[model samples]
Target: MLRSKKGYATALLASSVFLGACASTSGLDGINDATINGSHAQAQGAMGAGAGAVTGAVIGNQMGSSKAGAAIGALVGGAAGYMRGRSLDIKAAQSVAYDARQAGYQAEVNTAVMQNPQTNQSQQVFTGYRVLIPASEIRNQDPEATRILQKTAELAIQADTEVVASGPANLRDSVLTMLNLPAGQAQYVPSNDTKVAVSVMPRRG
Candidate 1:
């Protein structure tokens, strides 16, 4: 215990002498503690600004300023427009046209018209397409399958009749089934026929 006390007292005496020597230094002694802290803060700020400038330059190079921005904007905008063009209504018109041909009819598409389902809002007007089919194709088939195909065709037609577009399910399925209809001049009879629904083959993901 005595030795520990002696050691601590000697350390304090040495620190006091060191401080006293520093107190006699020239202009450094005139500077205050706040000045030292302020100097360190200024150095940190300068380093931060330099780093920020480099990052900004890199970003500018990649994205450009105006012209490059316009190009990128146009590309994205075009892709969005194409996707919108393939919306259900537009596709339904093509579907009906294609499906009619699949059913062995000479089909032609007429421009389609679309309307707003609400409050007679007409501004959403867009042209729809139509298919002109021959009546002979419906003449002979199992009544059940014939009815399904006819119903689907009608649904596809009705969907585009005014404005609202129907989903592809009806037309797609019917087209596939019509393409596969057995070739014969047989009349439809419900008891022997199955009410099988035709489906549109989906695109591979």
Candidate 2:
């Protein structure tokens, strides 16, 4: 059973890499389109200005009416937009929480971009993972406990993020050693709490 669980985790990690690549590409395409559209809007604005100057009275009345309409629409849509964004944030938080609960741990997830030294560019490189493992898991050594910790470490490494783990010395050391975590990629924090909390966060500029 342990071996099968390990295999499943390995397969998930592999598949996630491929899916992540696809998502990145799609995101880049969207960014590009938005940039291009912004430029296009600027050009159109300049053209419209010239046309409006040539037909000032007609254009002025049209602009005034449109501006009034836009203001009213903005008032109507603002609350909806806020609610939609809040809903998305809630769902993302709930998703990680649910996953962690299933694995017999507590967790949080976040996303951020980091600067790249090569081109002096900032890119969305990683999704953060924050996990908490109960102390009883350390005392009892159940398969679920081991699996969750192992999965957390694997995901942090996969995302190329730094992991800060706080827990009992023995539990922390054993988990770190088991994962063979790189010195630069992982950090240990001293904690008196009976639970292990691991935070995986992206590098900041």
Candidate 3:
């Protein structure tokens, strides 16, 4: 029975990896499309399995069946890791929103939790805020508008969140394109998914 359980757990992990890979290829299949910066499912699964195995072994030894304990531990650990990943996503989003608010933008922020079809797990997702800057203000190239955006980006960096400005079709495209480019690079693609236009800066440790 213990051996059977162990095998089942192993199979589950393998299945999870396969599913996650499949999900990654589909834009809408994984956790909230807007919140995924990169794939972390495999890493999270491995870590969970390792931690669970060790913990289960320890407990099983006490109960005269380390193998059984390990299988149970693996399941628990995997779930925990998935939850942690989701929480981190939310925290990062919230931090960015807060920073934007402090910079005087009327920031709209919200949290979401969803299941990832690939990993068969639930994750926390944060939809980044939309800063309500008027179309007229943006078109005028208002200095104050520029300052607000600049400060928001700086604050986002400090808070470890990416800033994606969404508003006014023409102005939004222009500003996001400028912000998304590298310091010397001038290429910018206009996007309907404005949430992804974060001016990513190197994270400070």
Top candidate (lDDT): 3
Report the lDDT tens digits of candidate 3 across residue range 1-205: 5665665566466545532432221111122223334323335656876897788778767767777778766765665554455445444445544555555555554434544433556555433334555545556766655655664454443334545444445665657543443343222334454232333321222
Clashing pairs in 1: 111-128, 112-127, 112-128, 112-129, 113-128, 143-188, 173-198, 173-199, 173-200
Please count the clashing residue pairs in each candidate, in the order shown.
9, 0, 1
Candidate 1 local lDDT, residue 17:
36
TM-scores of all predicted structures = 0.24, 0.44, 0.42
Local accuracy of candidate 2 as per-residue lDDT tens digits, 1-205 = 4543443354344333422331231111111111111122123334433443344333223545433333323322332222232223323333444556777566655534333221233344324556777867765776777776665565555434467888887676766764467787777877798987877654442
Q: Tell me the tens digit of each residue's lDDT in model 1 across 85-142.
A: 3233333444544554565543333322222211122221113333322222233344
Worst 10 residues of 1 by lDDT: 27-36
TM-score-better candidate, 1 vs 2: 2
What is residue 149's positional error in candidate 2, in angstroms?
1.3
Candidate number with the higher lDDT (1 or 2): 2
Where model 1 places Cα greater than 4 Å from the true spot, the runs are 1-87, 112-134, 142-205
Instruction: Give the lDDT of residue 166 in candidate 3.
Output: 49
Candidate 2 has an lDDT of 0.48
